[model samples]
Target: MKINIVNPDLNELGYVIAIANIKDKHDTSAPSDYHWKILKCRMIIFSNSSILACPDKNDVKQVHIIFNKAGDDYDKLISLFVKFSLIQNGGIRSATPEIYQKCFHYTMTARIAPVWNTLQDNYLINNRDFLVTRGPQEAVKYCIVVNDTFTVIEVNAVKINLMLTEEEFLPGEWIRVLPSLNKAIVEDSYKDFSQGSKFKSYKNLRRHWKNIHGYRLPENESAYYSIQFWRGEPLLYPKQCVLRNFPIVIPTSQPLEKLIISRFVTCLTSKMANVLGTKLIFKLEDIQPEDSKSLAPKDCLLETQAVSLCTPTQYSRSQK
Candidate 1:
């Protein structure tokens, strides 16, 4: 493996770019065997933060790393950093060009797990004079440090957020409405919820809806309606979210199931909102169940009578 460092003489912050190359020993004319192929990779790092950016160009025999700070281990991070550098140097294949092109356009927020405590302590003490103190609540901040060999990257935190209770859903009587109703709510608020939108697929929408709102599938089978909130604009990427008022309503009468779902949603939403530096709004309502097509009371009745359970509050950081 060989490494090259490239510094673009453009920005004042002085972004540092590193590229890695791995030679393939396998003969190209030989039969398609694993032993014949060589592995090559690339990666990029910004001076301002620890987040890794994908390459803007492409080459053959490339590998891409999916950023998941919470779930990725130290070994995985090291592997990704190497590949990221390779990608930055145009040594890897460009399977997803859009991702690489948009990599640097957005900011990523991630928490430092306790596993990297030693690294975090070292960075904090070394950069103590440059640290900025905010409110009583400590905000978590991390930076990526490369070694002299330029083969490894270490994640270190200068500050951390105060631990807060996870948001959860409470047990209550929720109205059961047709899936069409949920669709209508989303379409009304977000123009991108249409056919050409990224959320056109029900399965994709459901997955993201559950992930963003903190709803989880039940352990056992049971018949019940579920209420979920859809916050943010209907964008292809959650990190590109602009609007933050979309709400999803799932009506369920099952007390036990509703309680479980509510608690899970609440806890997850609170944690996600805080981590993403977004505000959360909770709207609760109780009304007589009606037919999906019938407008006995009016279409806007719920919106007018909705009660706010959680008001939006700014957090210290936002994660992708």
Candidate 2:
């Protein structure tokens, strides 16, 4: 969705102001999936003189904003510098000159508008722990249950994949695990086989299966049925709910290749989406940080020191 604000009253605000036309497509279809609809908006204000636009990013608050936007080019440049310094130094602690300079560099080279206000910060903090579904299947990876000992038990094959490996094998992530069930099983066994092996007896294997291995069919519980809206009607279907109560997963019949690419891209903007607390979209304009204030730190000296000295040096040391 795109919103165009044409010829906003510059006399009153002296700048063109326009609202992005936001459409809640989900509401039109799946009304319950999302509570609000958001869209990307762009405000282009061209004054007789060069309009200075400065953006500030605060780390403590994790918010970005544009401070002042009406000045000469030189002043605008300075304002941009200051805006960057503010964002890089908005935190409670002071930053190093080097850190402030780095922030300035980022601002000077910025291609997109910074988010305004502390809303971005809140969104980041809150959605940091969100369950994002990105595979072609969009199926729930597993069900999580905590034992009395506080140990978590994941209850699905996909969950096993995620926990056992760093490579993200989301529910729908496609891999050629033999198409035929029997063929797949034989391939899996061969893939796991090593050059030398012991315990070849069927009884020994059965003992291993009984004592060290677990075998069971997927659960067919009705509660596992996920409800989705089609047009104006509700449809009950199978879905994967993460171990956590939040972030329900629904599988798609699409091919695996397409799903994987789309999901990876979605992860990149997750930071922006969570920061803005708006639905995720490719449009960076929709992500507003909630006003102009540097959330990083005010003082550059301390910020640099913290990064160079205060923070853990394990990575640097390891490199050495």
Candidate 3:
């Protein structure tokens, strides 16, 4: 959404004064829920002036403002920086000396990947031990690694705040074996094959199943369900697993990929819709920091003049 303010009144120094409303979209019926959570607000000023007068004079042209949204109010009138002097043939520039910090603030709704099921349970066990012992040790570091092009990056272990509902996995889907499954049977039967080995790879194992167990392996390995058993724990045979109320966690850290960020934004927008009990309709705008010295300043008079139109009437009368 774009808002334009035209022909704003200038102050005594002949600078435009404007107020911008910093708000998120919401439904009138459910005032409690907000569609878009404004993590940060960036004010970009485009003018002919080379040097602008801003709230902070140290850096003149643009400013990044942070807002507090804990309150119930939605309408926030923020005074932005616009005062400045025009430098002939000057272009737009960022007044701040430091680079704008790239940060994000939004909520998301994502399915707990089947792999995360065991991880979450393990985390709870470790967390509970730490709490009981009151140890100074850091919590176990768990991350999700994704292959980006050729590079592999790990995502930090996320904590789930709310579980909206339980979603059942349909039959004939690939699922990871729970750690609590029988380890002895798995190790004794499939000692030759490594963890996560395909059922078709070991032809002898397949023959044993066909002869002893009286079951034949699926002709197409790709179509058959696959499972990732716990480390050092092999599955005796393929078994179907289903998920229930898989926890959804908040993404607290920035991801390496832009596509991941976009997904999070979409998920969060949908979650907000569900919370508000309203139709899901929203947009996300990435708040990227601007570079300094990008644009030149425009032409404007200096405020150094001693005589002004609004000088005190008493002083003027006494001097006369």
lDDT values, one for every candidate: 0.25, 0.21, 0.23
Better of 1 and 3 by TM-score: 1
lDDT (Cα, tens digit) per residue for candidate 1, span 1-320: 01112211111111223334434332222111211111121112222133334321232233333232333332454665554333232322321323322332222211121111111111111112111212121111122222222211121111222111122222242221111112112222222334334344444444442322212222222221223334433223221111122222222234533443343334324333321111333333222244222221122223334321122222111101
Between prediction 1 and prediction 2, the one with superior TM-score is: 1
Model 3, residue 76: distance off in Å is 39
Number of backbone collisions per candidate: 28, 39, 19
Each model's TM-score? 0.20, 0.16, 0.18
lDDT of 2 at 111: 17
Q: Pick the candidate with the highest lDDT.
A: 1
User: Roughly what TM-score does model 1 have, to 2 decimal places?
Assistant: 0.20
Q: Supply the global lDDT for candidate 3.
A: 0.23
Tens-place lDDT digits, model 3, residues 1-320: 11011111111111222222223332221111110111111112111111122222122222232222223211221222212211112222231212111111101101211111222212211122221122121211122111211111112223332222233333443332222221122222222344445333546444433322123434332112233233332334432121222222333334432434443334434333321112334333332324111111122112232111111112110111
Worst 10 residues of 2 by lDDT: 178-187
